[model samples]
Target: MRVAIVHDELMRKGGAEQVVLTMLKAFPNADLFTLAYNPEGTYPEYKNYKINTSKLQFLSRSVKWMQRLYFPLGVWAMKSLKVHGYDVVLISNTHSAKYVDIDNDALVFIYTYTPFRLAWEPTSYSQYVESRGVYRWVFDKVINYLREIDRKEAQKGDFYLGMTKETAQRIRDAYQVEDVTIIAPDVKTVNFKLSDKEKEYYLVVSRLEYYKKTDLAIEAFNELGLPLIVVGSGTKADELKRLAKPNIQFRSGLTSEELADLYANCKALIFPQYEDYGITPLEAIASGRPVIAYERGGVLETMIPYRGDASKATAVFFKEQTIESLKGAIELFQSLNFDPEFIKAHAEKFDEYVFIDKIKQFVTDKYRKSRQKSSPKPKLASEKRINS
Candidate 1:
């Protein structure tokens, strides 16, 4: 069977891109398609694959600026894919890969990271547009147009998968699709090691973006005067650095080995974002470290919150996004003792191997059923006798 894997874009490294990488491992022989590709911008493992890109690749050369055109051009790019001959077309989508044109017989499964955030979650991204008057006006117009296109494209998929219940709900709200299945993304737990000796510094492993709320960690850590290691780079990198105190140190461009070392030795991870389904917190837990996270979004589903027992708790939850709330959580975390082996065990449940097994089984079952439906049935013995 010919299998095709389509991703929205391969311009940067994040949870969405990680899902695509995991899919490639699951379907090693499948042909890979994308709207664009940037070797230096994304994970290096992609360079090993034979990647097919859409016409938008010319404009997607610039990893930073090209994303502004992704929603519109990404839709056009997906529509341009030659997925007709494939038996199964699996899309790792967040922005616009769901629009891929394919034959009616081809099974299309969309593993949605979320509905296009800019089109559906305007309030979360208001900071990006609110400052520029003319830009904001144009953005609102484009978003309105994209919403209709997104909803229409959503109907083309044979099945939909979401990373968490929160994202599943968002998919239903944005696309009016009822049967969204939850398939949580996973971490390569084997890459991380459980450590009993931890350094004094707290950790924050997130893209430094406005919506990610990395600034909350900076402010909270500044007041606490604790050593903090911020492990990511983004558009807000400079501004976040400016906001941070001397105790906060920033690092980026880390290899998997280097990152795992950081995760293992940190006192705990400070996660402030209301994420779709966070990988960093799981990565931290896999390293036998606890997490202090916001009490909303996917973290609620992943992190075992600290009530009175630390033995079963993997994290301490802050109710609000404010710095004070996170600071309070940190203080509360200091009083609790989490079991490293227990935390590590909890993270192992969402290992990459689990995702691979579930996805492969789902595809096999679906493909088998699809073939059963389409294949012509043999005549019964009585019918053959009658014809003779």
Candidate 2:
């Protein structure tokens, strides 16, 4: 079957993009569609596919700013695209990809990382804080308008695939939609390898965003006087660096191999954010390293408590997201002896093979059902005459 895959944007290589790549692999002949495509030295595999971008590409250098403004516009543009011939359309969305227009008869599968949390939790640290100005007012108005549009689009989709159980619950609450499936994110096992060589420093492998809580890790590491190596960069990088202590080291933009090495070698991976479904912690665990994470959201679902003998957990969790809380957890982990084999075992559950199998099954089942409903069967002449 011909397939069309839609994504929020192809501006950067992140967890969402990884999911899209997995979908592409599942349907090799599928054409990719996105709002923007700023390759900016991304995976060579992306170049092999037919990626169709929206008119937002006209922004050129101002692409980032345009994303904030043209989000709804991108959705509207999808209606103009000639995807009617495609048997299935799969959307890998963190944002507006859910808003794509498709045939009512087409098999539409929506993979949601989060149900637009920025719209629901506007005051959350992850959201863009705007100052009192014309731009701020306009931004708020636009965001509110787009949020309603997003909700409408979400309700129209054939099925919703959530990255985690927590995300499924959130989507149900936010959109009042019931047909949702929980599909955990996949990790590329080949990218991460187990290492015997240990490092004293803990690793924080995430975008240096406010919502990521990189600041929390920095503060905790500084207070504990522990060596902390941060790998990745984002909007908050410069400000976070200013707050960094002598013990904290920041490295921006590393290849997947380099990141996997860091994950394998570090004493433990520190994930301070309450993420939807963090791939980094899983990667660290797959590399036979335990994680130190906030005890909420997807982490609660994935990580087992480090305390109970009956409990089988791959990581230690902090009750609070504060620096003090994280520091205490780090110290506790340092004092305890964690089983690396157990950690690796837990991570194995989210291996690429499992994810691919589950997704393939879901798509195949849906496609079969769609065909069964649409296919015309041979009719009896008597029945036909009666109908006439």
Candidate 3:
């Protein structure tokens, strides 16, 4: 069977992009499709595949520019994609890629990170765009238009997959769809190993973005006067750096090995954001490190929260995303004793192999069911004759 994998765009190295790469591994012969591909911005491994892009690829190759154009032009670009000669089309979509046109007979499976957040969740989207007065008026118009389009596009999928229960609920609410299968994103557990080095500083492995709540970590670390190593870069990088005290240091563009080293030796990973399905916490846990995360979103499902059980806990939960809540969690973390082996073992549950197996099986079963429905059934021999 000819399989095709469609992603919104291959523009950056994030959790969604990583999932697309994993899908490619599962279907090695599958053709990869996207709206755009920026080689310098995305993972280098994608170069190994013959990535097919829409007309948008010719307009601009800038990752930042492409991201800015996502809402306005993404729907059109996604809809422009005409995927033919495929038995199954697996869409790894966080945005408009689910709109891709496929053969009517082809089984379309959408692995949604969440329904288009820009259209459905205005508060979260406001962080990325200027939303006040005239801008807000225009934003509202654009969002309303996109919401209709997003919902309509969502109906194209034969099956739906969500990374977490929270995201599944979001998908169901946004598209008014049912039965969203929960498939948690994976981490490369074997790639990370616990180091023998001293745990000297706290770690924050997230994009420096407003929605990510990286600022909360900076504020908390600044007040605590503890050493924090922020390992990411984004539009908020300069602003986050300025907000941070000398105790908080910023680093970016590190290799996997370099990141794993930091994860291994860090006091604990500080996750301030409410992610759809966070991968960093799992990565930190795989390095035999405990996480101090905001008690919300996918982390609640992934990390075993500390509720007076240090032996079973893999993380200390902060009730709020505020600085004080994070600081309190940090203090609680310092007093607690975590078993490194236990933490590592917990992370292994979300290993990449497991994710691959689940995805492959799901696709196989769905494809078989689709084929069975389409195939002609034998005619009944003893049917009642209608009066002429």
Among the numbered candidates, top TM-score falls to: 3
Q: Which stretches of candidate 1 lie over 4 Å from their true place?
A: 126-134, 374-388
Model 3 spans with C-alpha error above 4 angstroms: 127-130, 374-388
**Model 2 weakest lDDT span, ten residues long:** 379-388
TM-score of each: 0.93, 0.90, 0.94
C-alpha RMSD in Å of predicted model 1 compared with the true structure: 6.3
Superposed model 2: Cα runs more than 4 Å off:
60-63, 66-68, 71-82, 125-139, 309-312, 374-388
| Candidate 1, position 81, lDDT | 70
Error of 3 at 222 (Å): 0.6
- Candidate 2 residues 58-129, lDDT tens each? 563344565555655555654444445678888887666765556555677888898775676665544457
Ranking 2 against 3 by lDDT, winner: 3
Worst 10 residues of 3 by lDDT: 379-388
The superposed Cα distance between candidate 1 and the true structure at residue 186, in angstroms, equals 1.2
